[model samples]
Target: MSSAFEVRGGNRLKGEIIPQGAKNEALQIISAVMLTSEKVTIHNIPDIVDVNLLIELLGDAGVKVNRISRDKCEFQADDIDLAYLQGADFKKKSGRLRGSVMIAGPLLARFGKALIPKPGGDKIGRRRLDTHIIGFEKLGARFNYESDDNYFRLEAPGGLKGTYMLLDEPSVTGTANIVMAAVLAQGTTTIYNAACEPYLQQLCKMLNSMGARISGVGSNLLTIEGVTSLGGCQHTMLPDMIEIGSFIGLAAMTQSELTIKNAGVESLGIIPEKFRSLGIQLEIKGNDIYIPSQETYEIQTFLDGSILTIADHPWPGFTPDLLSIVLVVATQAKGSVMIHQKMFESRLFFVDKLIDMGAQIVLCDPHRAVVIGLGRQHPLRGITMSSPDIRAGVSLLIAALSAEGKSTIQNIDQIDRGYQYIDERLRNLGADIKRV
Candidate 1:
């Protein structure tokens, strides 16, 4: 049954949830192995099913990976068994993972070429690789369709070179491809208007530490100077910002106070202010944030004092992935907030489940929803529903906890992809939930 999570709902959760390494960052960082043959040590790595699958994928392809500790690992790609990457079993397992697509550029970098099948992830919307493909093409790579096998063969004819490339959109995978390609190119490469999310920045940092010359670390304009080789470097992954954000929403929804440690507040620029518009109180303590239990909160309206709207953008703005969680948190606040998800057409469809639970939300369109914070409107009672994606599953979980009755969340595998043992972690904070 695709692995479901049955969450018994209607519990006030109060506890400390330690953040794990960022999944998005980990995927990219691990893929960087193709740039060198050194033994790379990554600390603060998240132990999740997806990352495990990625490691298995790496090991299956002949990379030596070892678990040095709970949050640390060692990777050496000197002996990748490229020939073994074929076959149905490999394709099937890789198809189950979204990050598998990320390996193309690295594999090409490591072995002059890559044969990759179509990758998979949450059924969010159309995720095209035109940007990624074009980036590779600009660097001397030629692509051909392997129609019978449902795969793409990208081969660098005379090796990669530095070039000026513009992405159609600030695609994260595209940026990663360019970053990996640039690491081994013969000259300098300039990427304009790239996706500069904190996770992406972390990847750049790790790559730079490994001897790749990359400038403009936290900006849209990235300048990478291709080096002949990169040595192994030790890097500690940052705490999961999404997890911190989730906790912020959780604390506000159930009127529970929480002090989140090592939230990397600098990396969360504008996020706090963004949450404040929804009346979420946050007290910053160096790198930590203290969320006080509140009895009443309201979403701020327009500057002229009209109903306000919160929307998603590429980066340095609201992440589209978090829009679902924002929708649920808005339901507990005491005002109205419009959620405009510009990227994905069907992301707002999940709100129908919220509505079924008596939430005061109006699905304005396929991409927009108006959430009227019910305060205590119909208090979500226990219900059973299937998780749709990674973020959606966790948002549903937070909503279920705020509801007054018992609820069971099916399809928990989605939640496991991003968050680590969410039920067990929340239970430590006083939540009433049992996964059966």
Candidate 2:
């Protein structure tokens, strides 16, 4: 059964909240556990649906999973059932999860063969698997796609041989997948235009700890010296930067005072500044973010006095995931700003729902929108809406929390896939929200 959130808007939430572990990082790191047969322990795993489902999938594949706690688990893939990969159960479960694609790189590297169903996740835009498939082919893996059942079969009968490759785009998952596959190859592999997100860096660091030689972790160029095998290692995920960004936007939208605890500020790289550009005041004190309540905030124009435009780029640039949050927060600001969602075509479509809630917004195109701050002159009115994706779902929730009267948000499962105990956490911060 699907869930919905009934939100009574116009509540000034105030409290301290800790973000869950990084969701993107957890997916890569958990998948990396399969690269080693020895026991691997992961700490700070998010209790979200997607991560939990990946864990369950691993368990079903003959890996021994011991849950140390709600946020910690140990994985040992010593006796993986390779036959399960071709079974209906694996196809059905993996098809529902996009993260399941990452498992292919590890499985192919460690076991010489792997199969994956066409993965599924957010419908924000076109997410191509070309980077992954091409990288695997470069590493001596030949793959064939079964169009009938939407499955991919990859094999390296002679073992993988590493080679230099340049990615057309700096895709985070693509980089992680290629890097994981390259780690166990027979020779040196150099990857240019690789994604250098903090999560990716953490994956490299964890791989290094597990006896793999990887360098250029925090940069776009990565060099890996392939090892014959990898061992187990413990890794703790960084705090979710997307969630931290969401909290900052949430505090500003509801005119609430909120303190986000242990936000991993250094890894946030440019996220805090991006929120500040919208005139949201935030203080970074000892890795925590403090957002003060304000009756109104103004948007900052460019130095040349042009309308400020926020566009998504690869890491070190603003993340694409938080663009929805930024767009929603701008609805009540004091000036105009253009949100250029350059990465995904459909991300800006959610602005229509914001417009329905009395937000002053103009959908310029599929990839862009201009938001004219309401200046608090006219408060947004609550309305019923369906969440389009994970990021947009949270964006709508933020809008509903700041609007007048009550709002019903359907498809909250999308929200739960990314956020952990969101409604319960919001309740702790005095938000008048409940799950139905």
- Cα error, residue 186 of model 1, in Å, equals 1.4
Tens digit of lDDT per residue, candidate 2, span 103-140?
99999898899887775999888888999999999999
> Model 1, which residues run further than 4 Å from truth?
2-10, 86-88
Q: State how far residue 357 of model 2 sits from its true place (Å).
A: 0.4
Give the best candidate by lDDT: 2
lDDT of each: 0.83, 0.94
User: Which residue pairs clash in candidate 2?
Assistant: none
TM-score of each: 0.97, 0.99
Give RMSD to native, each candidate.
1.4, 0.7
Cα displacement (angstroms), candidate 2, residue 211, comes to: 0.3
